[model samples]
Target chain A: MAPKLPPHHSLQHSSTTATAGGQVHDDHDHHPQPRGIMRWLLTTNHKEIGSLYLIFSLIMFFIGGIFALVVRAELFQPGLNLINPEFFNQMTTMHGLIMVFAAVMPAFTGLANWMIPLQIGAPDMALPRLNNFSFWLLPVAFTLLLSTLLMPGGGPNFGWTFYAPLSTTYAPPSTTFFILSLHIAGVSSILGAINIVATILNMRAPGMRMMDMPLFVWTWLITAFLLIAVMPVLAGVITMMLMDINFGTSFFDAAGGGDPVLFQHLFWFFGHPEVYIMILPAFGIVSAIIPTFARKRLFGYASMVYATASIAVLSFLVWAHHMFVVGLPLAATLFFMYTTMLIAVPTGVKVFNWITTLFRGSITFEVPMLFALAFVVLFTIGGFSGLMLAIAPADFQYHDTYFVVAHFHYVLVPGAVFSIMAAVYYWLPKWTGHYPSEILGKWHFWLSVIGVNLTFFPMHFSGLAGMPRRIPDYALQFADFNLVSSLGAFLFGFSQLIFVWVIIKCVRGGVKAPAKAWDGAEDLEWSVPSPAPLHTFETPPDFKPVQH
Target chain B: MMNPVQRTVFRSVLVLIAMFAFAFALVPLYDVFCRITGVNGKVDERAQTLVSEEVDESRYVTVQFITRSGSGLPWILDVEQRQVRVHPGQPTEINFAFTNQSGSALSGRAVPSVSPSQASRYLRKVNCFCFDEQRLEAGERVEMPLVFQLTRDLPKDVNTVTMVYTLYPVAEEKAQLQAQVAPGSGGDA
Candidate 1:
């Protein structure tokens, strides 16, 4: 028979009571954790795997950042000084591939792994073993990718887009290795996404209805679905690339009756949704952070969810916007241009909702809140530039220019990367059982803000002045901006060390945190103990839907 | 029996596999889509009825021909006539001359693009060299014929259509595949 529960604990664990054999037991026969390195190697625990992913992404961040600095250092002046154009291309390409695939994406996944189960009052991810596999595959994929640098012709120099012929016939001998590595990474993403979707849909606490789940959980659910839908498409495109390169197939070879433009079609079909895959999770993170720091319930929660869904759906239609200057027909260009512009409506709804969430609320400028606000402002700037690029005729001028570079960096750095930083600061106390040093976090945030702007802002002017991207050197006319941008890059690159230091310091020891780390934060995650126990919600917590 | 969690995971895996198949399906799907819409300048291959069904003599469209060779293809390509004016539905003939600049026998394929791409939807090719591969001996020069007609219903604003034929070097294996498919074939009709 189930033991009678006290009213307070009863409300939270109602679902536990609903289960027929829900009585708590010591369960002394639990599997013992292994010793040392093997502990992390073989653990199926979500938190442990989450830590591994977070650590891996951090390492990838610095590596990809170093590559960026190499590009910046080379472009510091008008003439080639630091490296040859060949190495420069490799740096830019690797920098993009690593930062997108390894850094920003895995960082989001790490947060999801850590927070989803806690927020939903579940014991762990639905498929914990799959979670471990996903985290492990990342390092393998990235290792193969970085190893290409040592190959005879260096790594993939043909831009991260890897437009065909350049990636096919004219590709380096190491291109095969690149394709293989991408396959591994794609498998990891697809498996990870499956785990997330299953966990979210099937593993929620009893009585925790769909709408009752936190925005972070909701956003990740959508993001996971998007991942499942599109990562396969990425796999498909890369597979075709492999067949075209190794086999005598003409999938992209025009002489073989294959159209090079077809590759772009397939790529952007996956690529456009890919942009949202990176950002939707950021939306979830910011929504959670803003509400907590504002000391109020999130404004327009339903609209926020709708907006994210609309953005995901609209993402598919606007892919051809990326090909505007690729010589699409007038009707296609117009259709894609209009569809791309329509995305701004839903995106605007999200932005307006964030500001309204803050309006007239008792707001605190915590580290997470600061980053979230910066994201709102800077991501909007990127959105405006995106709108400008959406005009098919105007795109002819901005395509392949630093303007495009600046646009994406604004969205990524402040938009996605900043949100990840905000999430880390927001949840570090819960994870570590100690509050991080606020002063150091602020310094990190300010420096990052300055560094990001300094580095990317000037690219706009240079690009508008007809400076193309992926070049090691440029005309003397663009020298001043390049110098300033490089200086900013170095400053931003080094400033991240403070973030690492802050996390380490916090983990070591600091001000003790209560179960509710933040006074205004409301979620199932906050209901758990600080330094969440090794096994959480083993008997699923009772769900009492929070009242707004 | 699988638990609810197991069922959901199994279903998700199925969806993922289906999507992977869908991605490959997109290749043929895109081809069919382009053929139907005539977007992306994909020329429709279905032979049109030769009855000269609807001829609009009142409208004359100026079609400009542009010919070029892809880099390192070792071929010089030119159109017999740079431009021609033809009444709607009236079959027009143009010739593209190709000279193999390379010393060895080479195989080449021509891809046709109709621009202002909007006009491609109404630009019907009765017969063109783009449908087949052309193989030439060293220093061989061949003139290929393209017979086409402009549909009467082509949007009134599109008074001019530029057709560009880009000659690309064919892979040896692809050339062999082409030979296998159609043996002893020269330039088509």
Candidate 2:
């Protein structure tokens, strides 16, 4: 059992044997890929599978956006307008589900799939077939999730958190399907996470050390670990819901000797870490973009990595923060409050580091850079609101209010979603061999920033004024803010079309890109040709340690 | 087929299955938490040893008995007297009357819940009919006895303690008896 050669060495060994003058090297016998739909179905190529994940997530984003619009439209002017209250509930529920699970999470995973291999100078993921399987499972899961709308009693209206009793005894018949679909999605997430961990650990270029890897990869490494640790817990809770609904079990029935709050304990045990899961990758994306645009090596790269790991660890201890209003003991509430606030230290570290990276550097506001900047300012605002929500007493007022809505949207839209847009703008030239139109890109960026702020900022005023969330109609006092929010939502939603146009134009060919597309870009990825070769790094690039 | 990566993937899949089972495990885990905290006011199933020497004679607590028939069971249940005044640590007994109003014989169970759950742990039971199921023939009427004592350690602020007994038909068990009872044969008078 001689040790097998490294993949690159083996490729070189096999190809050198097949040709006399090295003019005709054929390694396709080992790495043969078929054409057309079967390529996506049967191919183990990371880039192709990455494309699949990105495309799928983009479609889900629109679907979720539409659901949010429906919610916004109904809340536009107080009285129920376009949709019935029941459908509005469904819209909010589905919007949350699709956005969190189907859109933002998958989008981050897609970026990981596309960039991790290139950045690490590896040929492909550690287990490419498993990667493909994970990618394929998402569509199946979401399709099943969407089909539940046609269920006899309608889709899940128990809110995205799906607390028991409401989700079990009183839920529509489609609740079972919702649980099963979530289970499928959970399985997909766990599989994808495992693949990511394996790839990062096992497939880095020969000379690269753990500290030497990009911040994006570091954040993902922690995020992947969080996924592995928590997604299973999510599966566990949802399965309990399934049993309570189908079996004669009393897991959540007080009448049958079960406690409803227990369901919340189990769900938040998974749910809290899940919120970090959504945001940590955004941290990574912003970390990557800020340094590049600022023309500096990232300020305190080691601290960034430590902060990400700390946030992940702290995430587990603070899940009950979401349950403060549900009657936790004073000691328990204070403990959760302290732990939740402690998260601010590392988060503040990350924000401080980004600003320091930007200070006194030759900064330029390209589309990606602009989005990254907005992410910094707006995500911090979300963080402050989160800190307020962490104070158990203050949260009594903030919980389940439109203020809570405003807080998370600030983090998610400007925070996570903005970083995603930035990642696209930063990476598009690399993926497509052409640059997106600068004029159109800036238009998309400005509209998105304004639209996002307009949509979510007013909700804070409405929330502070005591308007509750999830209601289709609000009191007359809330009418003005709701109007502003709806108008902003429409503006934000419509402005995204310009982004689509930019991407399509780029992919169809515009300005040809050089090997290093961005002036200040640093990494193994930029060392490769634009529109990276289909099968890159047959021989892994020699590692050159980056200088600070 | 069993490459190292495949083996790792397989192990992750096993962890998933184990976690799925663990979710179900939380049901019993939650019950244990409740029991330890006495949070839900679920009385212990068996008799608790009484602290004989700590009886409080000066304080009189009002003990109220409340009974109601659960949804499907046609058992008429009520406490003969709604309330009793007793000293802490002194044993007390109350009679609850139950009648099977259904046309056929049926089995039933009564579950007890204590209000002001903070003091639930201090309400010790000496002997009670709630410990077992009671089966009765059609039109059967019987008086059941409940025996309990409040510990002297019960919070001073809790002056009144209400114990509610909700009687539920052991309907599924009754259905099981049907196969043994042979539906058309001598089940009814």
Candidate 3:
């Protein structure tokens, strides 16, 4: 007979008796963990793999941050003293590539590896070995890209977007290496996405219908779908560039019956939605944090889900918003403008849902919530800037300048990076069964917030006053703003070190945590034991649906 | 309940089908999308300027071709390179021929852009397909040829409009691939 109770231990097997020592054997089997170095390579455990990815991402984050510090260091007093202009361009490009692909992205991926299955009541990822492959490919891809910096002609100077002709015949000798690296990264993304989608779709508990799933699952599911949808487009664009460089194709050359403008269309097609891929997960993290800190069931779960899907659909139409300054036909321009404006509707829904979730609820300002609140404020600032950029004619001026730089940094730093930090604080208890050092986390949060604003805010004025982006050096008029931004960059860079410190202290051991770490935590993740083991939700969880 | 290993296999097979179905639907959906959004490659035409007239004044001539385009990504326009024998230091006009075979009407202007890779700026235009877009409305046919001169600004030898252009398609498979792949690429946590 299929024992119908939701897969828990037999009452006799679950006896409260302890073994000879203090260890409990009612549930866990002592699978001798392979000793030492061999463990990471051969291990298929999701948590182990997640820690590996997280540590690797942090190291890359600092490496990428050092590059940002270099860019800032150059702009500190203006006459280009620390490095040559050419090298400076390389720094900016490398910084962007490393942060997006290496730091922010992997952080989220690591979190997903650790939580998604636990959150949704699955035993393992839909694909385990492929998980190992995806994580392994990252190091290889990054190594190739970093190696190109040492190449004869120097690494890619065309910026992370790598627009062509600039990336083509006019490119550095290492452009080929950059292209190959991106290709590998794309492969990794596709495989990883396939695994996520499968796991979510098929592995939920019998009663955990889609709506019953946590917001994190929903957001990641959407994120995975978007990845499957767009990573290929980026690959295609890079492939065309590769061909144009080696073979003679006019995909970007107008005189050869090709248009360079087409390259922008293709890149932004993948690029614009890409920015969303980075942020939507942040929204999910904040959603979880706010409810827990506020002690409330999320006020409008369905609305949040609808809002995310709407934002995704709208993401495709609004891609051309990035190309507004590139000069398209007038009608095409108008269409993109309207499509871009429509996104605000769904975005408004998300913001409203979050506020409602917080309203009237008992609110606590934990470190995660502190980061989440800052995200709301700063991310809103980024959004408002985005709205301003959406206006067609205004974008002509803002297209390739410091204002755009300010806009993205605001979104990415306080927006995406803050969320990642928030996630670490929020979930560390669940993972380590201990609260991180509250004091250290606060220091990290404050320094990051102040540092980020100082770094990015002044760029708006310099951009308005006519300083272009992606340039190594700037005219004297733009000096002071650059100085403030650079100082902010250093502060922001060092602030992240505190995150490393806090996480280490928490993981090593701190205040003990109970099963439901937070009083208001309602997700299935909390139903399992904290310090969620090598495997969990080994059967499935049972929970009553939160009635509307 | 199945053992952890067995449950994983059962779950994996189920999830794979669901994901494949989801990805499979995207192609037809995306195509339907292109048709609807008119994100389609478009066309606009403009009246041409008779930018050229053979001058009888300076007997010295140079022959060159110049290329220009409505799009930014380079396009592969079929340029027929022919040896147009001209006198040294003579300002001579050479006609360069090009065909736009792409589904979208190709728009481009050519200047003998390749040389000492210099003097290209003054390599003026006569007639260009890029005078406006040639809307090859689907199977619509159009010829985008160019006319330019190798200016006597030649130091004894510059003579060809190796107008190298790189063409970019409106969309590529890689972008489509990335779109499909990125979300699932991360860890299971």
Candidate 4:
């Protein structure tokens, strides 16, 4: 599939100058490349920018992990042994904020940056400069957010949701900074989403139709739309917060003719879609991995795509499920409950497609496949709990409890985070020209699986047993679950160090991979050389659509 | 001439801005939705001049009044009558006594909500103290009247309506009064 390259080793420079018709002319390296730190700071190359995003998210993952560990340590034996209630609140808040905005979202974006162009046979992201700009904004945004911890009032003590009145009238002086940081992050996400949309819509190879594109690209295209639709709602909600906090507006303050419940409405409107934004890409990644390892065409490719689009649509309708305990009217409660339950149908379809794909095919449990299988089982568990919570009456029992914690953590940790680890293992051969160490990868995978389940599964029982979430202390009856959860958290947290070591080892040296890293991998990405030349498909590869 | 890539980005940015506006739009939209559906237990702040004369005498609804002082408001509030039984269209009057317990002058505004929130629309206030802020001198006490009538068309299943009035401190009024008292000192508090 390799089109003969030009004799000179030319960098695949996407034309900075946009000519008419949106045709990106490939330009060879003309100017001398800057060296060292400047190369990363000034580069607009998609691969470098992708690496930057991944690295940044990795760093944030550890930071957020440490915060989680802090909370877990405090909950180890129950009686607020390590931290005060205020600082505990900060830890939980910061942990959530960092994981959602800084870690998971960026990791997906990073993967999109690295894989989308390769899969679609594009020279680079359509908006390369914008890609550079978006990646850089995260550091500034998170730095401003982290710096709030040092401010006089000592960071956001309100939960990550930053619900009103607590975040406004009673919030510390540092909340304004948290708002600003979130604004910056929202802008970054908007720009990044726009870039992905532009790239996916405009940069596919000459013969590659929308349906012909890989699942990752398709999922990201939808995810980008979700981001564009909802990130601004987040911006708007936070801006309203800014007004309420500083401008004497009562957007959320009851004294000023504003209802605090309005805050929940606006928040969940943005937030529910944000949840999908994190997971849809995981679906895309797993869809690719399952078919590859199972050695069979995905059983229901069309159904999978339709199910994904339907899930995105249903996400908008179900935001109120999160607010069931806040006294929503019965009709509204029914509307949200029915809509929320409706979401399970599409989600179930995707899960069924995955299982059917594996039903009779030759399957090997490569590290990526192992994680993908775990994702399928555990994410379904999460989905079932979500369905339980969707029943408004049942939600009243589960709301603000460890059950809610267990549900989301099940989906996010095993579901989304595991997919990322899977993707890293799946693509490391392509990115680094070497296979990741199988023995170490298995250890990392097993420990993570055990640690994550141990950490979250007990929360289900404890939550059902009536242990509320976000508290620094627990009753003596809840002590055993807390201890086990805390130990599991530490184990899961440390296992990640092994993941980092695997990545570093793979990048430096291992069994060298060929152009097609995995035998069953059939995407346009496999057409490129391993350690994929800094410039791939500079001259567009003639894409041959494989009949599934 | 804008390229397709540039156009997609431009349109996406528009969508982003539109969604931001939509978020703010939700505030008024939510209010309108609540007003139409009576979802959030919000009682209409405007006084209703028209009171239904056709009384539903056969059906009686219990009207309960509950008063709460919000945090930071140094005031005690009491109702002269805790509960009243009235025909749906009959006007019912209740007296609320407010006492400023703080040493300094203080001002507060009352916010009202009705339980069985769907019934909020049917319970109309002919006149209420919640329509304006009340100010009191140190240790001063005042009684305010609330006259309301549940419209004859109140939901059949609803036999009782609870009106909860929570008084919140009005900071702006206190600041203005302080500025009037001391011209030299900043009234920024």
The CAPRI class of candidate 1 is: acceptable
Per-residue lDDT of candidate 1, residues A278-375 (tens digit): 99999999999998998889998888888988998998888889888777777788899899999999999999999999998899998989999999
Poorest 10 consecutive residues by lDDT, candidate 2 chain A:
A13-22
User: What DockQ does each listed candidate score?
Assistant: 0.45, 0.32, 0.04, 0.57
Q: How many backbone clashes does candidate 2 have?
A: 0
2 or 4, greater by TM-score: 4
User: Candidates sorted by lDDT, descending order?
Assistant: 4, 1, 2, 3
Clash pairs (backbone) in predicted model 4: none
If ranked by TM-score, best first, what sequence of candidates would result? 4, 1, 2, 3
If you score just chain A, what TM-score does every candidate get? 0.95, 0.96, 0.94, 0.95
Model 2 Cα lDDT, one tens digit per residue, A1-548: 10111444544311222121113323434554465677679767777788888889889999999999988888888787788888888889999999999999999999999999888877778877778899888999999999988889889998899988999989999998899899889888998899888788767877889999998999999999888878988888787788888886767765566678888988888898899999998999898899999999999999999999999999989988989977665677899999999999999999999999999999999999999999999999999999999999989988899999999999999988898999999999988889888999999999999999999999888998899988988899998899999999999999999988998999899999987899999988887878766656667777888864
Candidate 4: RMSD over Cα atoms? 4.7
Alpha-carbon local distance difference test for all models = 0.85, 0.84, 0.72, 0.88
Q: What lDDT does candidate 1 reach at residue A87?
A: 93
Q: What is the Cα root-mean-square deviation between model 3 and the actual structure?
A: 12.5
Backbone clashes per model, in order?
A: 3, 0, 97, 0
DockQ of 2: 0.32
lDDT per residue (tens digit) for residues A420-458 in model 3: 989989999988889989899889989998999999999
Which candidate has the top score in TM-score?
4
The residue-by-residue lDDT of candidate 4 on A115-164, one tens digit each, is: 99899988778878788899999999999999998889899989999999
Taking the tens digit of each residue's C-alpha lDDT, what string does model 4 give over B1-37?
Answer: 7778878878988888888889989899999998888
